[model samples]
Target: MAKASVNSPSGPASVETLTTRGRKTRDALLDAARTVFEDVGFPEARVELITAAAQVSYGTFYRYFESKEDVFRVLSDQLFEDIHHRGPSDSTLSPAQRLIAANRTYYQAYRRNARLMAIVEQVATFNDDFRRLRHDHRHQLIDRQARAIARWQQEGLVRQSLDPEMAARAMSAMVDHTLYLWLVQGDEANEALLLDTLDQMCLGALGLDQD
Candidate 1:
């Protein structure tokens, strides 16, 4: 009941039309790609495997993704967007309370997506584009954290001498490294203790809770 067309050949006529079935088939390929990538890791995953998993013809994949990496790039973009959970929404929550909520949400999201996250790290190791992608993602967060710190400094919540960029990067590292170890690296540790420690460290770094 839907319309679709072949985009691989680069024809406007094809791009302008696709059937519902065509859309379904395209989605199947993407879904299958995710499964295959997660199972074998991106480096070893084959397009044939993805096609087989999707129950689609080999030619059908080409109609959509130009290559394995193309499909992977699409999947990676989606996953990275979801990697960080939203910040606090409760306007009444104290800054410390908001930090705790944000940290908790981040930890939970990371745990759920650990497998894909691990693959992202592996892919970034040798792939220049993915490496840059990872760096840019971090850089963005650093900027946000720096802005937040600057605001806190103005409110006299944190020391004025604290460098916003430096502090943000440091605290961001603290949370990222800790979770990467516990979730991605499968380090053995008490989950509650780990999260508690993260909360304490972040709060102290922000000069929220101190002696």
Candidate 2:
């Protein structure tokens, strides 16, 4: 059976004709690739390192992935999925509560995947496709948040004067950059204080503090 297709530098590539055992092997290679990338970064990472880490032959690596970059794309896709968060769906909760819950979820996910995130950050600096992928993912989050803010504004839960998209972008940057510093850059922080302050800042920016 065909596995999910991922974009390569040349074009889209599919992992064609995989059995149950083949799927396990492919997953092993991906896990090893993630470890290697996190340990040595994208530029230093090699197929041999991944194969060695996976305990698979170098030839086996090519069966699942076309190249190092190909496997990295798959890893990046997984990282994106891991980090993607949507706000709480409980309609009974107040807007402020939902926002706080969403922020908490995002922070927790970032903490769990900080190493991979750092690798992706480094790769995005030099790789055009990775850079675009990173931006697109961030923008998707921002757009969703913007729509939420607009809805809150319509409900009179947010300040009418604030532009939803701009506010969303600024608030998203505040949360994302702060997490990068604390988690990826190893900045010292009190976890409770950091999260609480982030919640307050997000609320205050939207005028939800009044509620």
Candidate 3:
């Protein structure tokens, strides 16, 4: 979406340029914004509510953020960072085991940020900027997985007939959509069973020999 124009001569201060105290205040506003967005969503959320939740004033809010959409973008960036984190990889694990571990880690991250993700999903429906942001992040993830699948295929781990990028995209959709259904849509699910099923489905799609 088009950014709301700020009246300031210098515009919103970059996070790097903020003083220690300024960073604290900005962080407070971000924390408050996340809560407000999760509780009331983007359309209903107002700067006043965020400032009130942060125990700050309108001047303080404007000092850190250009507008509500700006703060939401910051929060969305953070959420994506956390979701994108893969942590340390264990080289000793088999490809199949690593895939399961990756799925588990992703699922856990999704569950932790499920509330904010729901809000992001809602915002993306009509907001072009957010829609592109969401799509770009997903594409990055798929690209990484496709590369891994291609490597595994060369190593004779995954089936030669499968297209790496297509398999990655399809598997990603399965996991992502399933989590949205269970977490965002509040579909009842048993965690262990669901994750195991997802792991199995991904492995099966790659035609990997789990033996």
- Each prediction's RMSD to truth: 5.0, 4.4, 1.1
Worst 10 residues of 2 by lDDT: 1-10
Question: How does residue 166 of candidate 1 score in lDDT?
Answer: 97
**TM-score of each candidate?**
0.87, 0.90, 0.97
What lDDT would each prediction earn against the true structure?
0.80, 0.86, 0.92
On the 0 to 100 scale, the lDDT of residue 73 in model 2 is 80
Candidate 1 matches the true fold with a TM-score of 0.87
How well is each residue in 148-190 modelled by candidate 3, as lDDT tens digits?
A: 9999999999899999999999999999999999999999999
User: How does model 3 score by TM-score?
Assistant: 0.97
In model 3, which runs have C-alpha deviations exceeding 4 angstroms? Answer: 5-7
Top candidate by lDDT: 3
Residue 96 in model 3: shift from native, Å? Answer: 0.6
User: Which residue pairs show collisions in model 2?
Assistant: none
Q: What's model 1's overall lDDT?
A: 0.80
Residue range with the least summed lDDT across 10 consecutive positions in model 1? 1-10
Alpha-carbon lDDT of model 3 = 0.92
